[model samples]
Target: MILGCGLQRAKKRVEVSRTMGSNTGDQFANLGRALSTTASVLFSAQPMEETILSYSSPYKKLLHETITNTGGGSSLVKMHRDLNLSKGKNKGFQDIYANSKEFFKNSYSDSKTTFKVLSYLSDDLLEDVPRDTIPKDKNLITESGEKRARKSKKQDSTLFQGFEASLPVINETIEIQQKVTMNSDMKPITDSESSVSNIEEEQRQEFSLPNHLKAEKLNNSYSSTYLKEAAKSITDNLDLLEIQKNLAASEIRELDIKLEKLKLMRELVFKRVAKIEQHELFLEKHLNNVKDRVDMIIEYNMDKEISSSDDELLSRVSESSPRTGETNEDYETAATTPLELKDDDASPLLSKSIYQQLQAHERKADAPETKKAGSSKKLKDAGMPNRHRHRKTYPTLQQFYETGSKIASFPKAHEEEVICLDFDMPFGTMCSAGSLDHLVRVWDLSKKKQIAAMSGHLASISCMQMDQYSTLVTGGRDAVLKLWDIDKAISEDNGDHSEDTDACVYTFDSHVDEITAVSFDGDNLVSGSQDRTVRQWDLNKGKCTQTIDISFATGPMRSQRNAPLHNSVLLTKEPPAIGALQCFDAALATGTKDGVVRLWDLRSGKVVRVLEGHTDAITSLQFDSINLVTGSMDRSIRIWDLRTGTLSDVFAYEKPITSLHFDLDKIVISNNEPTIKIYDRENGNHWFCGEENSELGDVEFVRYKHGYLVEGRSTGDINTWAI
Candidate 1:
């Protein structure tokens, strides 16, 4: 019972130590169990030995020698002898422990004897027990009794002395540990608090026991290391995800840069090729001139009657050079004979055209002489462009002016005067117009209806264009250019022609001033603004990628005595803005309000030439392979030879030109006189004409199906005509 009580006390002490963060409590607990187990084994080993001995009190001295070892009782007795047990205390403690266990056991098991045992083991009975076994100096009450129960006072040494001796060694080890660690402030650990701190760190690093024992340890306040590992793993995964996302973004950026570079390179290559082709055409034309001179020489020496012309092959008076038809008889005989003339020399005699024809003949030896109209051997033989030989040139003065027929007209095509127009797309019979009403209107020639109206500009719509597929692009005085997806109207879809168009695919608002003109050169958009800037936009990026400052490209503004007025005010000084813009292969043609038409190499941003003719602000300009035509408020249309940079011709108009339309055989002039007139290309004679009953804003000869006209008028209407 005493052992059980001591074990319960030790258990409670371990709980308190664990709470205080002491790890050595577990070792103490193990030592206590070992002692309790050994004592119990000793007591059970000799249970009946004492009883039998007392009963045979007569033979006590003689029975000692006669007793036999039972269940190794001799070894147990020897163990007790070697233990150095305290003499009186051992006997007293054993008796009290046995009495307590018996009393407690009987009090619980048998109600009749429970009271007797309880009284026997109570505090009164304990007071009657021997009191000399333990010493009071060692904190024991029984040993300090007034009588010397044991004859020797020095024999009462205690286990507490040994326990006290080991404490210093524990403290020294703790001090050593303190020297190895740092404090919260990172200061050197000191021996003053070493014992307590070392015990806490050791307890925290301790491991729990078996599953059943770990139940209590799990409730400990300190968190386990596994929780930190889990959190670290999650953080690592997040970091990895961030790295992957960044890499993917970098890859996409690289692809975009590569694509943009490729587009620039493609444009450059195409321009170079076009230049090379133009040069070849020029060289070929010069070569053909030389060939024609040679042909004239061949024709001169033929057997025809010759007028008295200069001669270099004759002596003073005889003029006895070889006969003019001297080789005729020889040519006839040689042509009939198999003469061994060199094929190489003969090849040089053939014209490039003749050479191609012979080669084509050889390739299609079995083909019939008949041919397709646009692409045919007959057109090649006729010395015409095989691509469009069947197509007629521009109408004659009589055909366009006197013979044109009215096709269709829209009386209310826009809310205000139309300002700009563009055709030449494959729309079959449709035209697009921009107006001062800040809207873009689409008119169908066949149906004669306003198919759609696109509005986004905050100010007047200054310029409008349609791409090859009839995609609409418009720019306005608001400095904004918008690209629209108008495939619905272009395709003539029967589903929803009445619905208003949606927002533009791209809105370019980079210009700080009004946008004067916008044009598409292939997929890229070039826009000139009153900000004195021209920007090239990438369709894929929906943003400008290049800017050209034309500040250095202007010519001196020519003053006019009688320039036109707008809002009853005479235009005075030069406008520091781009008024007209056009993009071609590797080139940008910009006409400012100063009437100076400057052609810039768009890629290099360098001015190639400045064409000066118009005396007032440039209204419109057009360019083909051969000539540049400019119309202005000076009431004049000037044509410049593109090759020679010289003014080729000039025509006077009755009023300021609103627009100029150039073709291979005609130049259509539209002015503020409410009339559209046509002129013959060969003779420059005015012939056919039309009337809007108001100032004409713009006009365009229909593409593919020529002689058909779409006109934009000042009174907010569209008119279509035919020749």
Candidate 2:
């Protein structure tokens, strides 16, 4: 609208010029043309400005696309038009066009045409006129720029006047641009000078030193010298530290090697120890086998010697018998002498008396028969029994009791406590010990080692006895009796350390309670139990032949159901247990816990007599054909004549008697003390056979035969003292 108003004013001025002269009208015409051209150029620049601004501006397209995308169903053209119209005039406005590419092309063409038209007009207007024709004026400046050092020149022509008005402003802009260019060109020099000054100030402050210090001017050379020295010293120290580190590493490697060697040595030592232990075990097993073989060899030699001796004696007997020159029956009778002696001496005595009576009759009838009988007697005297050779001369039991010392101690007789011990009497070569471990161990007294270990009893063996024929009878707390063949046990033990199979000959479970005492003579075995009964068992029958109930209380008798030997005898209504039992010939002597000794006739099974002299329980008692020896916890040993039933002798001790056994000449007694006391019946001498401070323990059982006294201790030791 402003351009249009300018054109109208120019047309009105042209009419006024036409009314003036032709020259004035021509100048006005030119001025009008210039104004029109300038307007046209301004109008054409709008499109070019939009093109440049849109090409450079990210904000405009972002705003347009954002609105276009965000408007959803809204018109895309309407949103783009609104974005175009919202750009402020400062950004230069463009006419609404749907295609920005077509708009950009049309704007480029218009800009080219506007530039050519301006150039063509500028070519005509920039004619180089004479300097005197152009006027320099000051009043053409605007009133607001009064402070301007320079002003526009006035011109006669209107176009020249407008041009001259803008010239000073353009020149002012040019000058300001030149000033900015000059400052930019001088920046490096100014910055370089300022940095140099800052450096000098910093150096002056840093090395200013303190008062009273005097030195030459500080320079980089002095600082560099000390820095080099410090660097050299640090490098030297680093080298030394590296050398030390290398040495330390070497030492660690050597130590590791040594540790490996030590580990190998330790492993080797452990292996060697294991090997040695295995070898020791092997040696121990081999040693046991060797010992078993040696025992077998020794037993074989002893048997061989006995057989050889028997052969020699038979030859002598055969040779000597023929010299007597008797009939076949008489020779047969003479040949059976050894057999009759083994059974009983009575048959041999009766036979000999009959022969003597016949010889007396023969002597009365003929003198030749008497001489033959006397010569036969001399030959019999020369042919002594072979058993006499085995008999060795030894001190009597009294002499042994006085001078005997513990010649041997067998500690490992049983694994448990020894409760009872018995020897194969007369020789005392073989002895058996019963222990709490339910095992009976037999030891060879001559060899001093265990020969057999017998296990059969279910409970601890309370009492045991070994007869002359190697027959062992053991009674246990199980109230059962077991018969063990000592010969079989010894033979089986030749192969192994323990004998189990066939070691027990028989187990007799007849008693109902613990068997306190047991004794056997010939075929009859008697056992006394806490059941207040005495039982007699037949070895041939393996059954109880008789049970004598001693209790005065009237009750059902388990023994009377069996065949009764005789009428029963009742005594002691308080019921005393038979503690001590001894069987000899046809009599059974039982001592009750009440200290009364009863002699029962085995043929009648009736108490023949009761001997009551003991003040305490009878611990042990033994009777022969003539005398009865009884030892009691009352500390007294009483000797009573079996026929009279009267106490004949009383020997006292300081300690209570534990066990006692007597023969025709001497009585051997074991008391609570370690010693075994002996009383010589013929010499009236009494002595002990143990040390005063011996470790014999409490003697549980004692056996004295020949010259040796063997006592079993509760400590599982069977100690022997011999003279």
Candidate 3:
């Protein structure tokens, strides 16, 4: 029986042993499964832990206490539950757990290790295991909870007071571990056992730990002191980066501004260069023109020198009479005698003395011959011959018109008529035409001849005048005021006969339309045109100096737009007629088609007065020392007091007076009628009359030194009478 009991007991012991081993294996499997589940739960609950950790200091303290009481392994479950109950209440419990598992798995391997460690301790030691080894059991049970509460309170105080101060050291240690794992030389932890081995190995070689670990330990000891310094460093670096960015932006802006300024400067330089080139070209052209003008002046002076030498030679031939039967050489010797430059060269005083001697000799040579009486000194000029015998017979009327009418009959015929007969000057001459022919014949009663045929006018000559240099200036419908050198043309014909007739010494092309009248000061020539414009021409330079518009009083003609016309005639209303142009000392007077006499101050180009009273066009105008006399188409002659611009007298004429003149004693007026009448300037009384004629154009008067009056008629007739 004993033997059988022993065998049975042994079998029973083997069976019990087998059951225990199976139970232990089952428990290990269960523990491993539980650890795996815990690990998954911890991982899934990572976001909840992070949310709790990110709270404000006081809130984080409460959360840390809750976590410690729940235990590290179960904290994730509790966090998921609490989060679901709080703001994340919409999430399903299972979904929350799943997401948390993913989060922890990505974040940390420690989560799985911690759960596995706790599971192994619980399976091996059962209730005898330390509370910390089985953190979930201890955290959940009421008895261990109290201990955790007390520990958590103490931790809370430290956390609130100094947790921030330890964070840097903890981060530094974590960073060191990460660096070791990332290094190419380091081996990876392949299994949990290997991880555990590595941890033990790390602890054993503490003295030979990596530089990162040593740095971490030092950081932990000094972290609280360095926290503010590290923060300050980060902020300073940020500020420096911002400063650099701003400086770069400012530099870009400055570059843009500089580029714009450079562009403008380049444009200015180009303009300056172009202007300089233009100025250089203008200077070159001006220099060339000046050179040509200088050359012309030199050539003209040379010609004058040659002409003066020829005159001296002719004067010597006239001064010395040649002997009869003299040889050609003898005559030539007398004529070629060089004038010696006298030492006491004709003194300035001798020039005047010589003129006085010549006048005295003329008087003696002109003395009448005396008849001798019966006795020696008989009645000293015995009674000059009968007054009738001494009387010079005047030419018959027919002879005056036949032989004396020739234009060459006048002395000094080479000179042009400077003053018109209508002017107030004592020697002014008038122009006349018997037919509609465009011929203007000027007669001088002093010399009794046709002085000039003022031609070159397309229409009937309307007005004429002369400048200071005796240039025959005429204005007509041809839109031109020509300055003719009557003397030069005549002298050229008589002397060389090769000079061109079309050649004018000087010409002005200033008037745009028909030249109505032309007058001159000593320096400037003034012309009035049908275009209602007045231009002042510089006589010496033969160019226009200024032009003034006068169309304000009479509006511009619309028929003529901006078209340019040549010297061709166009039909318009009876064309403007210029009655007279009178120039005083410093003023100019003009009578126009409107019968108004306007006066202008030449120096200032200002209108002085408008003399108005005539009802018809003023045909002729004359000015005396005190009065201005005007003959008009109204068949009357009117005189104006110049100083006051008032009418002094009006004399009725039988016909419209066409010409007027003031002869020291009377005013003479000529019209188309036969008779020429003279009126006294003071009283407007009829003074004298000339022989009748069928057609008369103009009349003029001549004053003699011996008080005689001479008259010239347009029909080539002249008469002289005592004043």
Candidate 4:
């Protein structure tokens, strides 16, 4: 029984020893485990053995070898007891570090929390442990502790010696970094006291940070702010430059458009200037021609010698220029004085005619038959009246036009100045004349005598027309348009009737002002007056059918005029007046004083086309089916293509064109000059009908058709030429 009791006590003793060993050994192993875990987390996935081995403590190799190779045994427990005895004041630090590392790794998963727990535990341990218990010298309570203590003391001495050696460099580097940071974030510290205070404040912040972190904070602050500001400034500059570039591009485009327009305008001006220069040269050439012709005729007259009878004939021709076909008793005797010119100013055409007459008188006694045959052939080929087939000489007078000599001349046909004239065409058997004396006379070309006279107009006749049916239409200045039967007027003038009926078959009076122009085409009559309106008349109805207001069709237009009012010269502006008119079947062309020609569709009374080129009042206009020809006081005749509304041809004359007529073959124009000008379209030739010594007067009204030219002169003379 005593032996059994001893065994039980022995077993109890072994149990107590094992429990004590496990408790103490576990505390040491846990202390090493917490340190290894902290080092692994801070250094990133390092092995437990290497982490433990990196420490320079005397127990480092043993702890790493035991944990990695042996795991746990008696030697580890003995080492733990030895460590407890050697570091008695750090016992609570070991326990807290081990427990917190377990909590951090398993539940917290943060190295920062582990370090904070270690720091708090270390602070409490330092407070709880007695200062006397802390070891001061290298000596230890055990033999192994003595060796570990000695090694630790040697390592501490070395570390303190190295720190003392680098102390000045570390301080200088920190001071320089602090100064740079202050200058960037705030301002320069010029005052010594302020600089010292700023240094103190920076030192306090640096002290709170770890030694490694102090240098990083100093390097990053100033450089990041400076780089951001510089980048922002560069971005702003780039944006501004981009805006300016876009603005410049837009301006360049606008300038390009304006430059193109200016170029076109310049080209147009150049063309107009060139045209004006060419017209000036043409006028000068025609003037030279006229002067040459005049000089040649004068020299010829001066060089010739004449007999007394021829001289007497010439003097008689020059002196008593009486009405054609007067009795010989009315002739005055010729004076002994020679044919003379006052101040060498004789009419060039007059001298030429007198010289030709003398030559003709001399030739008549020798080959009178030969002369008559040649004259008859010339008249027949030239489309003269059939009277030339029977008569050997001109009907009334032996006068000639200066250029194309005339076949007949009714000199002094009217009691006053003749204003208008017309004749039947193709046959050319009858002719009519109207005068400023308000009398209309009809002449029979077959008999060479005046056969009819009608006196109904109260004012001067301005325009007249004749149809194939013995119908005559005349417009007078008294705003009266009269139509007469030519046959009845002639019968009445022959004293064939006893009735006192007026010759006027129709008298329409819709015009309110002086009629300026009139046109008659078959059954239609169109008239224009200074009232700025065009009236279309139906002869079948004998009334005004359509009235086109010039002002309404053309709108308000201004013309420049120079007039003497109240003895003062002033420039005036007025609306354009209707100055010319032409009518076809349903088409009418009206010209305004402003030089605008408008083509009207009479059915609708609306302007269809406007022809613009003349710069003054239009004096005359005539159009065929395909072309419109207009004459202006501006000295230009423009022919326009009606189908295309474009100018096809233009004729520039030396004097203002007074009257114009054109056909398919030729264009005839009469200006202020005594000559009648013809433009032959087929051969592109210009012919003047008046020559150097022709007694042609300034023709006021003229008509040409079927190669016959009838001109009414301002001197009350009527002449015909076959061309």
TM-score of each: 0.40, 0.43, 0.37, 0.41
What's the residue-level lDDT of 222 in candidate 3?
60
List, residue by residue over 23-52, the lDDT tens digit for candidate 3: 433433333333334344445655643433
Sort the candidates on lDDT, descending order: 2, 4, 1, 3
Which stretches in model 3 have alpha-carbon errors above 4 Å? 1-460, 467-470, 494-503, 554-578, 682-684, 693-723
lDDT of 1 by residue, 244-277 (tens): 5555677899999999999899778766664554
| Top-scoring candidate (TM-score) | 2
In model 4, the number of clashes is 9
Ranking by TM-score: 2, 4, 1, 3
Write down the worst ten-residue block by lDDT for model 1: 383-392
Instruction: Judge candidate 4 against the unseen true structure and give its global Cα lDDT, from 0 to 1.
Output: 0.60
Q: Which stretches in model 2 have alpha-carbon errors above 4 Å?
A: 1-402, 426-429, 494-496, 553-576
lDDT per prediction? 0.55, 0.61, 0.48, 0.60
TM-score-superior candidate, 1 or 2? 2
Instruction: Return the lDDT, model 4, position 135.
Output: 53
What is candidate 3's local distance difference test score? 0.48
Give me candidate 1's TM-score against the actual structure.
Answer: 0.40
Instruction: State how far residue 685 of model 4 sits from its true place (Å).
Output: 0.8
